[model samples]
Target: MAAAIGALTLRATRAGLYSRLTSGVQGVDATTYPVLSGLARVGPVTATKLAEAIGMDRTVATRYATRLQEAGLIDRRPDPADARATELVLTAEGERAVTALRGAMESFLAEEMATWPPGEAAAFAMRLEHLTESLVQGEAGRSC
Candidate 1:
């Protein structure tokens, strides 16, 4: 399982995969994928918080947030709780880009699984999702 997960991670992290996923989606690339996808999952958050959430450097997060802002894919707004701090939120365009990315990923996975029996693919997907959820929950618990 560990080897399989590692292989999947390696494959998923390849620039070619990201390039394919972000194709036709302007201003998005492997560098900005974590920022955009992190925002999609966690909603509005400060760059520092986003960095923490995504396990990236704060400077990198801030830089990518700036790039995304310039591309008009994300917005930087004053945090409601703090007048001095700002939060990054996806624009409508960013949402569309994320949707496209997700669709592409799903299509890619479907294509990869095309050779497998449909039931086996479905079961694997279900188990994978469950495992992911459980791991996330365990991490959340450990963080507390």
Candidate 2:
């Protein structure tokens, strides 16, 4: 299972599909994709929480957040709960980017599964999501 996942990642990287997918939105690479998606999932979060949610270092999270803010995809606002901390939130543009990214990924997978039976494709997607959720929950702090 691990090998299969790794192989899929390698193939995507080699094919530059990750870059292509991000390019469909705002020229974000694979690395920034996680940050954007993380914000989309749980925005108005401190950099530390965002980092934890995405399995990224706090510093890197801050950097990515900065870039996204500059791109107008994300915005940094004062944390009401913590006067000294800033919360990261996705802007309208960020939401659009996330939506576009999802579309790009779904389109790619849809193309790949076009030849497969509908039931098989659905089952594969469900199982993969379950596996990923389990892995992520079990290894919260570890990058997979």
Candidate 3:
């Protein structure tokens, strides 16, 4: 599933929309904002947990987090519950970036789907939401 998603993602931005939209940021790419948004969406969490939630390897998640940290987009603070662990959270800058990224994506989607019938787009979004919820539930079942 990840492989298929990865392959699709690689081609999804072939037009370089993400790059063009985020041209001012240094060392930030399409992956950077998504990872940052994932962190913000999940709130404060250990890198390992965040990785699992985002379907990324722990090492890769750490690398992304580290990059964002270096870029001042995120901050890592000591976990109050765990002495040896750290919690990742989005910095103010990160939050702004996530907000902008989400807005941009939504705007782009709206324009692209403007020609589609309203019900069809709504149905597609609903179907996607249901699928995502099912997957999350299935994972929770397995974890328990």
The prediction achieving the highest lDDT against the true structure is: 1
The order by descending lDDT is 1, 2, 3
Superior candidate under lDDT, 2 versus 3:
2
Each model's lDDT comes to 0.89, 0.84, 0.80
Q: TM-score: which candidate is best? A: 2
Q: How accurate is candidate 2 locally (lDDT)?
A: 0.84
**Model 3 lDDT per residue over 1-144, tens place:** 787656645766543776765665654686675578788888989999999888888999999999999998899999988898999988888778777777777888899999998689989889778977887889889987
Give the Cα-based TM-score of candidate 3 against the true structure.
0.74
Q: What is candidate 1's local distance difference test score? A: 0.89
> Which 10 consecutive residues of model 3 have the lowest summed lDDT?
6-15
Sort the candidates on TM-score, descending order: 2, 1, 3
Please give me the total number of clashing residue pairs in predicted model 2.
0
Look at candidate 1 and tell me the lDDT of residue 44. Answer: 90
TM-scores for all candidates: the values are 0.76, 0.79, 0.74
